[model samples]
Target: MASPARSLNPTPPLKGSFPLDHFGECKAFRIDYLKCLKERDGAQYECRDVAQRYLQCRMDAGLMEKEEMSKLGYTKSNSNRRRVSQDSYKKSKESKGFIAGLSK
Candidate 1:
């Protein structure tokens, strides 16, 4: 018996496509973010800075599309806001009880 011919069709990614960094252009930033994740015990929220850096590196290397940092949820004011929010969360947990803290 003869086998049927095979064909392949590829489509662009739903959100669009990005070039792969086969040259390891952003490998350092990727490593840093991964290390931060490990150090944070997989708490991604704590590694936002590192993750943002990694994205920035990818953009700079033309591995991904360039966009505003604010659009990506990072801005000069954001860092300050994050710090304040963390402080507030800590206070809420101490004074308002766990359930009340979550509301904050």
Candidate 2:
């Protein structure tokens, strides 16, 4: 019987954790993505935008590296250019409320 061959180049273990909630900046985006997933019955494609925004927030906060973000399907140009405003925050909450109503 032939012996099993070992791979020459093994994938390296991930260096660090992608702490999604370590910073409060991306909390809203994360929640939105999670809610979207639940609403869509775990359909990841439905929440791609929210997920991207959350990842962008992590990248902006230095919680995650650009290379790591790129590996996760985010592009360099996706970096957040402007800060979140109070008006937008209120709008997000209102949208969340609307989504919650749909779940009932």
Candidate 3:
């Protein structure tokens, strides 16, 4: 009798298959994303930030593989940018238009 063949690579599916988070490791993030979607009337694009958070939580919890957010189609969050002070806003308004100085 022939022996059963084994998979040469035992890695799990990269997409559409993930272990259930029975320990609720990412439950809060999932709930938050769901709430955002509900609030947006299911307009998923409006909930991209929350969705990203949920995905990040899953990755951190080992429920999914870690991946670059850029490769996953997410833009760099605004939190990474330097904050502009009220003084800067005023100065920009005084000089160029606020929108024009936004790129500075």
lDDT of 2: 0.69
How far off is residue 14 in model 2, in Å?
A: 1.6
TM-score of each: 0.62, 0.50, 0.58
Clashing pairs in 3: none
Give the candidate number with the greatest lDDT. Answer: 1
What is the overall TM-score of model 3 with all chains considered together?
0.58
Positional deviation of 11 in candidate 1, in angstroms? Answer: 9.9
- Expressed as tens digits, the lDDT of each residue in 3-97 for candidate 2 is 99987986654857665555488778778999999998885654667888877877788777765656776553443321235346657888877
Backbone clash total, candidate 2: 0
Best by TM-score: 1
RMSD of 2: 12.7
Clash number by candidate, in order: 0, 0, 0
**Which 10 consecutive positions of candidate 1 have the poorest summed lDDT?**
95-104
lDDT of 2 at 10: 68
Q: Candidate 3 residues 1-104, lDDT tens each?
A: 99999879677665757889999999998899899989877856667788899899999988988998877878755423312343466677778755653655
Error of 2 at 33 (Å): 0.5
